[model samples]
Target: MEQYVGLDVSLKETEICVVDGSGAVLARSRVPTEPERLAVVLGELAPAASVVVLETGGQSSWLHQELTLRAVPAVIVDARRAKAALSCLMNKTDANDAEGLAQLARTGWYREVAAKRPETRIIRSLLLARQQLAKGRRDIENQIRALLRGFGLAVGAVAKQRFETRVRGLLEEIPLLQDAIEPLLAVRRTLLEQSDGLEERIRDVAATSPVCTRLMSVPGVGPITALAFVTAIDDPARFKRSGSVGAYLGLTPRTHQSGETAWSGR
Candidate 1:
C-alpha cells in the first residue's frame, strides 16, 4: 500500500508522520531538520511513499532542492493554507501538525508552492540588502536634519556630498554639537559607501542577465526594478495568463460582493 508523509519542520528538528492511503497513521518519528537526515529516515519508514508534504518557509527552498536531489518526492505547500487546514484539529503540537499534514497529502488538499531557483534567491538577496542600506542612510540623514533644526539651523536643499560639509560648517563653532554629530556623520558616510557598492553590484547583475535586460526594455523600468521583478517571478510560466501578474504583485484592488452589493478597495 502506498503511503503519504508529512513533515512539520522547525529550526532544529522535523516531526514526521506517515499515513496509509486510508489516512491511518503508520509511523511517527523525529529527525534533524537537515534534508539528508530526513531523507534517510523517510527512506526507511516510508519507502513506498507517494508524496511528502512540507510547508513553505525560510528553509523550504533548500530542503526541497536537497530532497529532489535524493530522489524524494517532496512538495512544498503554502504555509497559510496548510495552517488553516490543520486548525480543524484541537491539538497543535508539532507531531499532531505532522500527522495533519500527512492527511492533507493523502487527501491531496494542499496548495503547492513553487520553490525559486538559487540564482533568483541570490539576486533577490542583493536587492533586499541594497534596500536596507539605502533606508538606513536615509534614516541617518533625517536624524541629522532633525538634530540641526533643534539648534535653529536648517540644512536647506543640499546635495549628498555637501550634506556633511554644510552640517559641519553650521556646527564648527559649537564644540558640543560637533562632538555629538561627528559619530552620526561617520556612520552615515559608511552607509552611503555601502549603498553605492550594492547598487553597482545590482546593476552588474542586471546587465549580465538576459531576462533582466528584456525586462528593462519596458518604459520607465530601470535595472533595480527589472531585477526585482525577474527574481520575484522566478518563472514566467508559473502564471497562466499575463493579466494575473498585477494581482500577484498586490497592485490589483480587493473586491467584496454579496448578493447584489459590490465594493472594491485598495
Candidate 2:
C-alpha cells in the first residue's frame, strides 16, 4: 500500500504520522528533529513509493534539502494554507496535525513549494546582515543627535561624511560629552565599514551572476535590485507561469476595469 508521511517539525522533536491510501493511520512516532533521524524514520515507514509532507517554517528549507540529500522526497506546503486546512480538526494536537498533513499528501491536495537554494539563502543573509549594520549605525547617529540636543547643540543638515566632524566640533568645548559619545561614534564607524564591505561583496556577486546581470539590463535595476530580485525568487523555474510572479510578489492590479486595476507596470 502506498503510504503518505506527515511530519510536524519542531526544534527539539519531530512528530511523524503515516497513513495509507485508505486514510487509515498506519504509524505515528516521535523522533529527534535532525535530518538523519527523520530520514531513518521515513525509510522505515515508507516501504513503497510515498510522499513526505511538511509545512514551510524556519527549518523546513533545511530539512527539505537534507532529506533530498538522503534520497527522501520531501514536499513543502505553504504554512498559511496548511494551517487553514488543519484548523477544522475537532481536536488539534501534534498527532492530529500530522494525520491531516498525511491526508493532504494522499489526496495530493496541497501545493508543493520549491525550496530556496543555499546560495540564494546565503545572498539574502548577507543582505540582511548589511541592513542590520546600516540600522545600527543610523540608530547610533540618532542617539548622538538626541544627546547633543539635550545640551542645546544642533547637528542639522550635516552630510554623511561630515557627521563625525560636526559632532566633534560641537563637543570640543564639552569634554564630558565627547567622552560619553566617542565610544558610540567608534561603534558607528565600525558598523559603517562592515556595511560598505558587505555592499562591495554583494556587488561582486551580482556582477558574476548571469541572472542578476540579465536582470540589471532593465532600466533602473541596479546591482542591489537585481540581486535582491534574484535572491527573492531563488529560481526562475519556481513558478510554472511567468504571470504568477507578480501575484507571488504581492503586485496587485493597479486598475481593475470595474474599479482601477491594471497590471502593466513592472
Candidate 3:
C-alpha cells in the first residue's frame, strides 16, 4: 500500500496530490509553501509514501535539504524535462502536472539537478553583492562622463580619484553646468566609498582562506580574482579534468565538428 506524493509549488501556495500504487487518488489539496507548513502536511500524509516529486525551482533546494534531514524521499526533477513529459498531454493544470511528476517518479523517468552546497551558496551571494556594488560605481562614473560631455569638456583619462579634483576646477569655469553636476558628484562620492568598503571585505575573506592562498600562487592571478575563482569552484575534485578549470572561466574555445563541417573558436 505504498503511496507517492507530487507537489506543484509556487510563491504563495503549493498544490499537492497523493496517489497509491494502483494510481488511485488518496488525497489532494493546496497548502502554504512555507517549509514548516509543507512539512506538517507531508507528516499528515501516509508515512509509507515511497517518493515525493517536485519540479526544479527556487524553493526546491530548500525543500530538498529539509526533507533530506527528515529522511523523506524527495526527488527534484528538471523542469524542462518534466514539461516535455507533460506537453504530450492535451490538458495541463497544477493538479495534472503534480500527478504527472509523481507518476514519472514511480516510473523512474526523471533527471535530478545538483543543488549548491551551503558554503558555495554563501560565497556566491557575496560575489553577486560585490558585482552589484561594482555596477553601481560604474554607473556613477558614466554619469560624470555624460555631464562633462554635455559641456564639451574633455578631462582626458584622469585617475578615478584625481578625476573629481580636476573636474571640480572645470566646474568653477562653468557655474551653470556645475550646479547640475554637483549633486551627482556628491552621490558618486558615497557610491565610490561603499564600493571600496565592499572590496576590502571581499579581500579580507580571501586573506583568511587557505584555498584562496593556494590559488593565488598561480601565475597571472591576483588575490581577489583567485579567491573569487576558488570560492566559486568550492570543490576542485568535482571536475574530472584539470583543463575544466580554464573552461569554466570561458577561456577555452568551443568547437563542433562533423564529416565535412567544422566550427570552433566561439
Candidate 4:
C-alpha cells in the first residue's frame, strides 16, 4: 500500500503521520529527530513512500539530506505557507500540524523548498568564520583608538603598517600600560593573519568555480561577497526572474496595496 508521510519536526522530536491515497490517517507517532532514528522509522513504515512532506526549519536541511540518501522522497515545505494552510484550525498541536501537512501533501498544495548542497555549506561556514574574525579585529582597533584618545594622543592618518609601528613605540614608552595593550596588539596581529589566509582561500574557491567567477563579474560583487552569494544560491535557475534575487537578499522594498491605491516603501 502506498502511503504519504508528513513530519512536523522540532529540535528534540518529530511528530509523524502517515496517510493513504484516500486521505485516511494510517499511523501517527512521535520519533526522535535524530538522523538515525528518522531513517529507521521511515524505513520501517511504508518504505519509499509516495511522498514525505516536512516543514522547512533550522534542521530541515539535515533531515532532508538524510532522507533523500535513504531513498525516501521528501520535500521540505515552506513553513509560512504551511502555517497559512492551518490558519482555520483553532486547535494546533504538533500532531495536528503533522496531519495537516499530510493532507497538504496529498492535495499537492504546499510549496517545495530546496535543500543546501554539501559543498555550499562548507564554503558558507568558512566565509562566516572569516567575517567573525574581521569583526573581532575591528573591535580591537576601536579599543586601541579609544585608549590613545584618553591621553589626548591622536594616531595620525598613516598606513596600517606604519600606524601599528607608531602605536607600539608609544606603548613601549608608557611601560605601565604596555602589558595591557600589548596583548591586544598581539590579538590584532593574529586576526590580521587569519583574515589574510581566509582571503586567499576565498579567492581560490572563486577561481576554481565557474559560477563564482561569473557572479564576481556582477557590479558591487567582490571575491568574498561572490563566494557567499554563490555558496548560498545553489540553483540560480530556480528563480524565474532576476528581480527575485534582490528580494531574496532583502534589497527589495516592501509595499501595501488596496483595491485602487498602492502604498510604496514599507
Question: Considering every candidate listed, which one attains the maximal lDDT?
Answer: 1
- Consecutive 10-residue window with the lowest summed lDDT within model 4: 171-180
lDDT of 1 by residue, 1-266 (tens): 98999999999999999999999999999999987899999999999999999999989998999999999999999898999999999988999999999999999999898999998888889999999998998898899889888988888999988999998888965668877789999999999999899999999999999988998889999999999888888899999999978877878878999999899994
**What TM-score would you give candidate 1 relative to the actual structure?**
0.89
- How well is each residue in 15-120 modelled by candidate 2, as lDDT tens digits? 9989988999999999999999888878888856388999999888899999989998799998888888899899989989988998888988887878999888
Q: Higher-lDDT candidate among 3 and 4?
A: 4
Clashes of 2: 7
TM-score of 2: 0.84
lDDT of 4 by residue, 1-266 (tens): 76888999998999998888898999888998887788788778757578999988778887899888877898999898999997766788999888889888888899898898777778887899899999998899889878877777666677766767878777765667776678889999999899999989989988998877888788988888888878767788889999988886789777888899898887
The RMSD (Cα, Å) of candidate 2 is 3.8
**Which 10-residue window in model 1 sums to the lowest lDDT?**
172-181
Q: Give the TM-score of candidate 4.
A: 0.75
Better of 1 and 4 by TM-score: 1
Give me the displacement of residue 69 in model 3, in angstroms. Answer: 2.0
Error of 3 at 180 (Å): 3.6
Ranking by TM-score: 1, 2, 4, 3
